[model samples]
Target: MRTRPSPRSRRHRRTRPRSAIRLTAGFLAAAALLVSACSSGNSTTSAGGRVEAALAELPRSTPSGLAPYYTQRLRWRDCGVPGFQCATMRAPLDYDRPDAGDVRLAVARKKATGKGKPLGSLLVNPGGPGGSAIGYLQQYAGVAYPAQVRARYDMVAVDPRGVARSEPVECLDGRQMDAYTQTDTTPDDAKERNALVAADRKFAESCGARSARLLRHVSTVEAARDMDILRAVLGDRRLNYVGASYGTFLGATYAGLFPARVGRMVLDGAMDPSLDARRLNLDQAAGFETAFRAFVKDCVRHSDCPLGGRGTTPAQAGDRLHAFFRKLDAHPIPADGRRLGEALATTGVIASMYDEGSWEQLREALTSAMKKKDGAGLLSLSDSYYERDADGGYSNLMMANAAVNCLDLPPAFSGPEDVQKALPAFEKASPVFGPGLAWATLNCTYWPVRATGEPHRIEAKGAAPIVVVGTVRDPATPYRWARSLAAQLSSARLLTYDGDGHTAYGRGSTCIDTAIDTYLLRGTPPPAGKRCS
Candidate 1:
C-alpha cells in the first residue's frame, strides 16, 4: 500500500506516496514510513454542520460552453512505469470563462488482465489535492489492489491540475523545503511566533513568485470539473471511482456537480466538505489524540514500549511522550547529519499513527532517541513524511498540498493573535497535538491567492449509491467525518470499520474488502449502516 503524508496544510490528510514509486532503494526500505505518514491528520468539520446553509444558497447548474472541452478525445501512449498508458487532457483554466486559458492534466491507466467481462473504468485517487494519482496507480493500486478487482476494470488515475505530472505548482527548492520543514511549528514566545509567521509568509510569497497564474485555478471545484472532462474522454457513461482521504472530498464534489452522471464510488477515509479550516483542524487534532490513545493502549500491553509499560494509563503515556518532546525542544539529538528536534520527532510520531503496522518501528525509534541518543530512525520516518529522497530532492507534494488547501478554504487563523486566542480550545481538544497543529493551520493566512471555495454540503441527490468507509479511529480523516459525509450525500451507504487505521479496503479486513469488491463487481452496495471489524 502507498502511504502518503497528510497533505501539507492539513498535516495528516492522505497516505504517503508508496515506496515503489521512488527511484532509490533507500526510500523503498523506509516504505513503512509512507503508509504511516499518510495517516497524519486532517482538519475539517462535520459535513452536517454548515453544508445545508451553503447548499441552500448556491445554484446547481453546469457552466455554459464547456461541452466541447468535456467531449474531446485523448490520444493515449505508453509512458513512465511499464504497463501504464499515459494521456493528457485539456480543461479550461477558468471554468467561469472557457476562453481564458487551459490547464493540462496528466492521466494514466492500466488495462484489466482478468478474463471476466470488463466492468468499465475504475478511477482511483490516493488523496492529496497534491498527491500524484498517476504515481499512486503505477506504484501501488495497479498491482497491489486485489487481483479480482484489477482483472475486470481498467484502473485509471488523473493527477489533478497543479499536482504532480500535470502542470505542477512549484514553491521551494530542496534546501528551502528542508528549512521549511525544520521551522519550529510550536512557538515558545513572541520571537518564535514571529519567526513562524515569517516562514509561512515567505513560503506563500515563493509560491506566488513561481506559480502566479496556476495558483488561482487549482481549487477543488475546478479539479472536479477536470474530472468530468476525463470521464467523458474515457467514454464512460458514469464515474467509477475509489477515492481515499481528500479524494473523498473530490469525489463528493463531482457527485454534487453532476448527480445524474454519478456511478459507483467508494470514498474511504472520507472528508467533510462542510467544515471550515479551523473546525477541521480542531477535529483533526482530536482525531490524532484518539489514535494516540489507541496506540498507547497497544503499546502499554507490550514490554518494549518506550512510552509506557503494562498498567500505564493512556493519559500518563501521553505525558511521557510530551515530556520527550519537551526534552527534544530543549536539546535535539543527532541523527546522521541532521538533528531530531521536537518538530521532526513530532512529525515522526504522527507518521506512525496512520497504520498500526508501524507502531513497532515507532517504539524502536523512540527507544533509540530516548536511550541511545540515536535519532536516525525517527529522522528517517520524518524524511519519508516530507517526501525527501536520499539525494535531498523533494517532490511537489507539500507545495501542491498547501496550494490546494489554501485555495479551497479561508485561512484557519487570521494572525498569530487569533491563534493565541484559539490555542486553549485546540489544546483542550488534543493536549499532545493541539498547539502544533493549530500553528500549522496558520499556513494559509498569508496565502497569495484568495480562496475560491467555501464550506458546503454535497448532496448528490440523483446520484447512484456511493459507499463511504470510515475507520473508527482513523488519525487524519476521523471516523466522524465518514458519518458526516455519508449523511450529507443523498444516496450514500455508510460502511463502518470498527478498527484502527486511515482507511479500510485492502488493509486486511475480509469484511471490508469483500463488501467493496461485491459492490464494484455486482453493482450492489453493502447494506447501509453496515458494521465491520
Candidate 2:
C-alpha cells in the first residue's frame, strides 16, 4: 500500500490527509466510477442555449507576445476513446517570459452530440492539481456528465502542466515509491523520525533532479493562466467549467485571475483558499476522522461488523481499529502476495473513507485482516489508492500530487519537531488518524522548490455567477470549506448537499444535479444557501 495528499490523500493519516491541502484526495476514480453506475446518461432535450454570459476578455486586440498562443487553431485527431478527440496546447513555460520555451498540455474533447446550436466548450477538471483532466474527460465527464449538457456543450479537459499526458512530473520508480510509502510515519523515536525525514528529502531531491526545470512553473496560478489561453483557443469569450475537489481551487483561481472571462462555472467539493498549509492539512485529518466515524456508524448497522456490534460507540470502534494497527506495527500480517504492515493497512482503510459506499467493502476487508489473517482485501484497497497495476508499476498520480502540493505551499512543518509540537492538537482534532497525517504534512517541508503562493482569499469581484457544491459529510473537503470558498468568491452561489463522499454533483442527487445542469445550460445558479438532502 502507498500514501498521498487529499483532503488531496491516502487511506491513512500516514499518507498525508487525502487531497484538500495536498488536495490529492479529490475527484478520485471512485467518484468517476460512481457516475458511470449512478447517472442516467440521458438528458435528451432540444435545449439549445449554452452560456452566452457577458465576458469582457477577447482574443482580438491581443498583445503580440501572447497572440500566437491565443490565435492558434487546434488540430484535433481521434483519441483512443471513440467519439472523443485529442489535441495539444502550447503554453509558455513561464508566463513572465514568453521567450522562455513552452510546455505542451494535453487536451481532449467530445463534441456536442445534439443537433441544436452548440453552447460552446465546457471544460472539466477532476482536481489533484495533479489529477488528469484529460483522463477524467475521456473516462467520465465526456460520457457520464448530464446528457443534456453533453448534448449542447463540447466536453473538454486539459491536463494541467506536469499532470498526466502533459509532461507529467517524474520522481520515483515503483520500487522506490514502495519503500517511501512503507516508511514509518508515526515515528516512536528519533531514529524512526530520521528515517522518515531522509525519505522525504530523497523524494524531494529525486523530483528536483528529474523535473526541476518544470517544477516551479506548475503552480495553480500558471495552470489558471493556461485556462485563459485555452478559453481563447476554444473561441469562447467566457469560459464555462466543471471543477471538482482541487479542481475547485483551480477554477476559483481562474475566476479570480480572469473574472471577466469566467462564465457558467461549477465548483464541487470546494477547497477553502484562505487557510495556510498547516491548517489545511490539519483540517484534512479531522475530515478523515469525520469520514471514519461515518464509516463506523454505517458498519455497526450490519451483523458482520468487525470493529463492534450495533450498540458500539464510534470512539470504541476507533480504539479497536487503532489497536489492530498497533498490533500490525509489531508484526505484519500476510496477504495480497505481500506482508500487510501498519502503514499500508492504514492507507487501505483511509482509501475507503473517501466514499461511504465502500464502507461495506472496508468492513469485510477489516474482518479478513483482523480475524482471519488474510490481508488481501486491505492490500487491494491500498494498491488502488496508489494506482498500482498488477505489474507493480504506478501512475504518476502520487508523484504529481507531491510536486504540485509541495510547490503550492510551504511544508506544513519545517521539521519533525514542529510535527511533534502539533501532535497533541492534531490528536485532539482527530483521535483516529491525526498523528500520521501530521507527519505526512512534513513531505512539503523538504521540497527542493520554495513555495510560490500563500493562504489568501479569492474574490472574483466581477465574474458571472459561479455555483459551488458542497457535501456536508464529505471526507476530503469538509462542508465548511465549500461554505468558505463560496463566501470568498464575490459572485458565487452555494449549493449544499447534506450527504457523504468527496464531491456532490452527479453522484445520485437529482436536486444537486438539476441545479448544476440548469446552471450549465441556462447559466442560472441556484439561489444562494440552497440546501439539498
Model 1 residue-pair collision total: 18
Clashes per prediction? 18, 27
RMSD versus native structure for model 2: 9.1
TM-score of every candidate: 0.90, 0.90
The lDDT for every candidate, in the order shown, is 0.77, 0.77
472 Cα displacement, candidate 2 (Å) = 0.7
Please give the lDDT score at residue 244 for candidate 1.
84
The regions of model 2 sitting more than 4 angstroms off are: 1-3, 7-62
Q: In model 2, where is the ten-residue run with the lowest total lDDT?
A: 29-38
Question: Which residue ranges in model 1 land beyond 4 Å of their true spot?
Answer: 1-64
Sequence-dependent TM-score of model 2: 0.90
Residues 443-531, model 2: lDDT tens digits: 67778887766555667778899999999988778889889889878898999999888787766788998999989888888997899
The superposed Cα distance between candidate 1 and the true structure at residue 127, in angstroms, equals 0.7
